[model samples]
Target: MTNDHDVVISGASLAGCTAAILLARRGVRVALLERRSDPDAYKVLCTHSITANAHPVLDELGLIPALEKAGALHNDARWYTRWGWIEPRSAPEGPELPYGYNVRRSTLDPLIRARAAETPGVDLLLGHRVTGLVREAGRAVGVHASTPQGDREIRARLVVGADGKDSAVAKFAEVPTTLHENTRFGYLAHFRNLPLQGGIGQTWFLEPDMAYAFPNDDGVTVLAVLPDKKRLPAFKEDLEGSFLEFVRALPEAPPIDSAERISKIIGTVDYPLVTREPTAPGLALIGDAALTGDPLWGVGCGWALQSAHWLAEAAATAAAGRGDLDRSLAVYARTHRRRLRGHQSVAVDFAKARPFNPGERLVFSAAARDESMARHMYMFAARLIGPLRFLNPAALAKAAAVNIRHRSAGVSPAR
Candidate 1:
């Protein structure tokens, strides 16, 4: 059937913008709908750290230098545990893994939105919110959107929900959802002159708790601390003070505590990390809307861009007139699940308890003590190494050996 556009993407967030840009680049007509009137608007609650895995897509869209010029920071990582610090190591060429850039959502999000608008065949409708999906015979065909002008219909060949964790389009598409008890709250802020030690992004895997501070461009930094639900009462009482105090409580938090505040401490309590089947007839979900995950791994932004690319590729194939759209959606769904499910599954599972695992503790501890081990741990943390690689028998055996050697050397084991 003839439609106003090839795709109507809800939510002008990173995923939506990326999807729109990708599709438009491929010659598909795209309509991007945003609920906010301000084109510069962004989700302040997010860390806004984009990883190395997302670089290729950004490069393809010609956004890498743009983002870097937008005050994004290029920083390596270091992990902190009760035992010690694990620093990042250099990699030999070959599209170095775990490479990443960090930019504030305020800057990054708007830049992407603008790029999407610039792409040929892409029309951005700001201040318009999609209330529901339009379906015919149980297949999504378009979206019902409400603009300042009032409610109206926008027809499209496919509808994409990039609306995030509480996605209205996903709900309208009638996709089944599963929610888990995520009792953890995230508190964060932007800071200036944070006394960063060793020039590496750091995360303190505190015993039964965790706190992180990432260095960014423009002399700014992002600090976040995640405490169990039961321990949130204090933070909720005084968001800034508790957040700062949590960071200071870490074994190596003096540097962060010394930093000057560049923004107010923002807090999100019991933010539900959810997952659902991301696709169905004529519709697909991207980013948090498709698979809400724990922010602890800092995988959200990367996954969002990556998933958008996946959908764009699959959609191009499905729209070829030779393949069934259903089959295309299924393929996209399977690929997403296979690529991310294993990793996110482990992340969600680990959220249930403190960081432990004889092998893990051993390797992480060794990383803190040895530079080589630190690189391996950093590679894993940065998502350079796949989950299966870490689970390999050889890797496990190596971890065990490292653990024994460290113990014999009188180094405190990471737990």
Candidate 2:
């Protein structure tokens, strides 16, 4: 049977918009729906830092230039652990290392959404909320949505849910979901004149507690703290005070006292991990709809963009009627799992609010003392490489050698 569009994507955020733009560019007709009517609406609770793994995808979408013009900071990262700082040293002879962006969602979301709307074959439908899926012979074929004017049935060969953590489409499609518990909550606010060393983002792994200083666009720096739930009472009692105290206690912390607070502290008290199967017969889920991990690692935004690229690449041919849709979707699903499942598992394990394990201690301690180890750790943390490679036998052997050398020199591990 004929369909209204090739694909009807619910949610016009990062994943949806990226998918819409890429698919449309490949001659596929797309309906990009967003529940919010305002064009400038953005997600406030995000860490707003995109990882290096997603840089190529964003560049492919022609957003890198726009992002740079908007003053998005290209951020390198430094981590402070009990074993001291793990700083990756770039080799002057080697190719330049990849960098991620530190731009607020307030600027990022609208910029991308506008790009998608202006693309040739994408229909940006604002104020359209997906309420249910249209199923034919036990396969999803379309969606029923509540639009500004009235309820409407949008038919398509494939339906994509980029609607985020609490996905309406995933619910309607009855996808299997697994929930993981997070024992920490977080708060973040913006500041002015808060300069990090070389404008690099800093993450302090204060054992069970974590704090970050990410320099963003236009000289704005975001300060965030993810303290254990046991410290919630103090933070709830006085957010500003507790936030300041927690950040100040970090080793060689930024000069927050001299900086000006620019935004009100915003936070989520509880963010449970959500993982779902990304595809069915004629349905697919991208971004947070597929996997919502602990946000402390700042992987959400990057994964969203990357997943959109993967989905669009996989489905474009099928949507154009040149290939089987289900087969294409299966390819996308496998690719997504292979790329993100290990990272998600690590993030969930950390979200349990436990102290670092022995392997973690060895890696972090060695990284602090050895440049090679630090570079590998950086690659793993940046999501540029998978966990298996990072924890390979050779890496573990190198870590052990580094630790032995430091011990021979009588240098304290905590130093």
Candidate 3:
């Protein structure tokens, strides 16, 4: 059958734009659709921190130079726990250390979207919402989109749902999904004059409660709090005040009081984890559409970019008529699951709002006093390695050894 485009991707956000750019570079015609009419529109309630795991993908997309030019900060992460700070020491000599970008979505979204729009084979369709799927013999052939001008059907060899957590494409396609409950609510806002030490981001694991201060572009620092759901009434009663109090109570918290609030306090009170099957016969799901993990871990943005790269690489040959489309999509689905499922499982379990268990306490305490352990923790948290590798016997044994040495020497782990 003839097709209007090689791929029809819904939701012109991070995943959609990245997929379009990558596929277009591979000579695939992409119909990039966005429901929002405004070109500068962005997701407000986001961590806005891309993990180092996605650095290779961003570099491949040629976004690093542009992101740097746009004043995005390259940041490592520091963690605060009851045992003390877990700050990994940077390598003195060797290849340059990997780092992630800290740029507001307001800047990031528009920049990538504009790149996609300007690409040769991408048709950026603004104000186009995917209303339903166009299927033949139970395989999606395209999408029925509602445009400002009128409803239209765009036919393609593949349909992609990059529309996020509540994906309309996934809904219309009836993809299987599994939901997990989150017992924490969150709040975040940007402030000026709130700089982090060494320009690194900080995350405080206040047991079940969590807070973060990520230094962003243009001298702005985004501070956020994720409190247990039982504290919802206190936050509802006074969002700004309660937020400040909670953050200030943390050990070595940023000077939020001395900073100027540059943005309104915004948040998501109810964000449940969502996992969906990543593929169907003629369709694929990327980013949050496939798996929405706990935001407290800050993996969403990085996974979005990485997933898009994986999808483009998997489908480009088939879309260009060099291979079988179904086989290509299946490959993408398997790759996505293999790369992400472990991390998603751990994040989902932690979202249950429970305090750190014994294993966690041991690791955190040892990490505070042992630079080697700290580095391993950092790599795991940055998603450079999966949970299985992070919790391997060697790492656990080292953690135990560190704690034992400290105890024998009568040296307290915490400051």
Candidate 4:
């Protein structure tokens, strides 16, 4: 069947733009639709922390240079636990993990959108809001959208929902999602002249709360707090006040209040943990449209770009070749599940606001004392490696030994 395009992607966010560029470069005709017409508008309810795992994707898209030039920070990380600080070490070659971007969505959205629109086989449909799915014989085949011009219908070989958490395509297609409760809502703001040391970010796994201090580009720091839901009364009473006080309460707290506030304090409450099967018939989901896990770890941006790459590779020739598109979608779905399910499972547990289990105690404790264990933990957190590899037999043994040594020395193990 001849269609107007090979793929009609809804939502011009990160995933939509990435997929359009990739598929168009693969010689597939793409129609990229965006609900917003403003080129400068961006997502504000995000931490803007792109994990190191996304470096390869950015490099492939030729965006790394521009991102770094835009003031992205290549900062090292230091995790503070009750036992002490767990500073990961690198080899003589330098930092083992590649640097991730802290670029604001304002800067990145335009870059990604412009790149997608400039591609040869892509048609950018701005001001087009998708209202429903077009299905044939129970298979999603296209999208029905309302544009600034008027209502429109576009048929395609595949429909990609790169929309945000409340995806219209997923809703119209009746895709099932398992919503996990997120007890710790996040509040953050960008600050200027935060006086970071050696450009290292901080993660405090405090007893009942957690905090992050990331040095972004342009000499600005993105500081944030993830407080339990029960603290809503205090937080709601004063967003900025509660936010500042919480940071000051951390051990060896920085002079955050002294820094110039570059942006208003932004927050999100009871953000739902959304998980769904990424493929359904001729429809596929990417970014938050696929799986919205805990935001505390800040993995959403990286996963969005990575999922787009996965789908591009899997379905590059499905529409043109005489291959089964469903089979190609299956490959993408299976790979996505295998690569991310373990991480998501663990994240769901943390999202529940429960304290760490014994295994977590041993791992974090060992990571604090041993360089090898710290490297493993760092790599896992950076998402360069999967959860299984991070908890390999040798690593677990090292963690156990580290805790044993701490006990022998009369030092408290990390809880």
Candidate 5:
């Protein structure tokens, strides 16, 4: 038998769940198919940090209050370079530079699915395993899935794939993806009673070695290290001991050794940066299903929420009879391409685990000295804005001027 809705979303993670909430609020008939039956299931491997790009979506869903109540931390990030720390000059608090959010995936995932299920126009089909696409005339219509009772056929005007890196929907639709090789491995763990940062997140960039201390709720700070594959030998012998030693090696190491670890260290050895076309035919992909860039930047969750918002807006319009459904899909594809491609391209480059080039050293050195450049670096790092448009000859010249001044003062610019 055919169960029908205006749209069917597969994978009830942040992207799929957020899309369901938005569409349901707009009175669109939406079915969210989640493979996981347990309400508390989430991606354990994720850092669970989302940049400010997700603020609007969180506001629209009325989730900020709930997130705060659940002990989510608003992260103010500090970037470190060889010269010194590059801090964002305080702005009058507002959405323009809103603090990023951090919450454990175990807590956050259940919250997202529960909220979406509560909305009026949503059908939350938990424990449904998607088998294949339901297509007609070379366009996706829905998905064939399995529930505990029996096989089910779901039909919809559109099908959304919010599944992660190995997306079943993307595979079923034969959507081509571009994958870039990543040359580094990463490990992270939660530590308790770390030195308080007043809600600030710290990142130390030691050339090819990257470490972060993100102060989260529950008075615990998450520490992560991403080092080139060549540096893996020491870690292979003693993961915990080597990890602590590595942190202690960092310049002015962030007091991690004095803290007690709350969770076992988790890691990923090799993963590729992936990008895919956001939409095709009657189908669309969001979150890691569409683009899985370098996790070192912590943009995954934000992009997930943002892409869900983008898709919901387009789907909402089509559902309300304002435009052709296909046209809306094309619009999503265009906007997604325009916004994320450059960022992913840059991320893939950095994922090679190479040391900063001369140009990067100049930018880092200058940003440490110049307030305007530091603000730009902060904005770019937070993903509040992309840097390509204004990072031109003028920016370089300004950085060069800073470098010249530092040299005259007998300060080194070869960071």
Candidate 6:
């Protein structure tokens, strides 16, 4: 028997939940399936930080109030170089408006799924695992799923794969996915009362290695360190202690030693990530499933929500008779490619090599040397300005000029 709906979404994480909420609001009947039995399930290995641009979508979804209640921290980030800290300048609208935020996935994922359940046209199906996809003449028309009771067939005009980097739906659809080799690994954990300059996020760039501290809502700070894959053996031996030591070794590591750890010092060797094209045929992949970039950029959650919005807009338009499923899928692919392909390409390129270039050294050094440069770099770090936008011809020229002037004055650019 076929369980019918206008759309069927697999995976109930950030991307899945957001897509469901948006589509349901458009009066489209949606059957959102999550393999997990828990309705509040979320990704355990995520950074859970989102950019300021993503806040608009949160507002559109009416999630701001709930997020605030959940104690999400507004994260205005600072970039630390060998020179000094480049702090985010104050904006009139405050931290949330100018910078991004940090909310644990444990808090955010459930909040989003709960909102999906409240959506009028949404049918939340927990503990149902999709075993296969049902296709009609080379187009995705439905899905075959395993419910606790038994096997079931769900037929829909559109199928969305919101699963993470490893998407089962994309595999079943036989969409050719491109996978790249990652050379870095990550270690992370949360600590309480860490003197991490409470209320803001900081990232320290240590040439080939990187470390970051995010002051989350619960007065707990999440720390992550990205190191080369070759160091895995040493890292595994003392995962927790080594991670803390690595942070402390940085030029401006917070006084984490004085704090109490709330969670185990968990670590994963996969620092970088891979992704396939986000959409194909009758199925669309969002979030990590589509294009997982280096987590070092902290763009995953924001991209997930943004991609959901794009997919929802396209899906809704198609369902409302303005377009067909194929057209909708094409629109989603184009929108997604336009929004993130360049950034992802750049991130991948950098992740594969050492972390810095001479140009980066000059820019960061200038920020440490000049307060104005620090503020500008902070905006760029917050993603308010794109790579070229911040490192524009004029900005680069100014940084170069500053370097030359400082050198002539017998001041060396900070390493």
What are the TM-scores, per candidate, against the unseen true structure? 0.94, 0.98, 0.98, 0.96, 0.95, 0.93
Residue-wise C-alpha lDDT for candidate 3, range 1-415, written one tens digit per residue:
7877999999999999999999999999999999999999999999989999999989988999999999999877889988878888775674555788999999999999999999999999999999999999999999999999999999999999999999999999999999999999999999999867767899999879999999998888889999999999999999988999998888887887899999999998999999999999899999999999899988899999999999999999898677899999999999999999999988888899998877778788999889888888988988999988888888889989999999889876543
Which lDDT values do the candidates have, in the order given? 0.80, 0.92, 0.92, 0.86, 0.85, 0.80
Model 6 C-alpha lDDT versus the unseen true structure: 0.80
Clashing pairs in 4: 71-217
The predicted structure with the larger TM-score, 1 or 6, is 1
Candidate 1 per-residue lDDT over residues 209-319, each given as its tens digit: 777778776777888888877787787677767776677777767566566787877777777778889998888999999997788778889889999999988886455
- Candidate 2 lDDT over 212-273, as tens digits, reads 88988888888899999999999999999999998888899899899999899999899999
Residue 78 local lDDT, model 1? 75
Q: For candidate 1, list the clashing residue pairs, or say none.
A: 52-99
> Judged by lDDT relative to the true structure, which candidate is superior, 5 or 6?
5
Residue pairs in steric clash, candidate 6?
A: 185-271
Candidate 6 lDDT trough over 10 residues, lowest sum: 88-97
Q: For each predicted model, how many residue pairs clash, with residues at least 3 apart or on different chains?
A: 1, 0, 0, 1, 0, 1
Candidate 6: regions farther than 4 A off: 1-3, 91-97, 320-322, 408-410
Tens-digit lDDT track for model 6 on 1-415?
2445888999988888899999988878899999999886668776769877677789989998888888998877777766677665654455533655799988888889999998998999998899999988888888899999899989887889888787898889877777666677887888888876645788877766778888887777888888877777888887876787788887756887788888877656764466677776778888888888788888889888889999998878675445687888888899888878777766877787475777777788887766567767767655556777677888888887777877889976455
Off by over 4 Å in 5: 1-3, 91-96, 196-199, 319-322
Error of 3 at 338 (Å): 0.7
TM-score of 1: 0.94
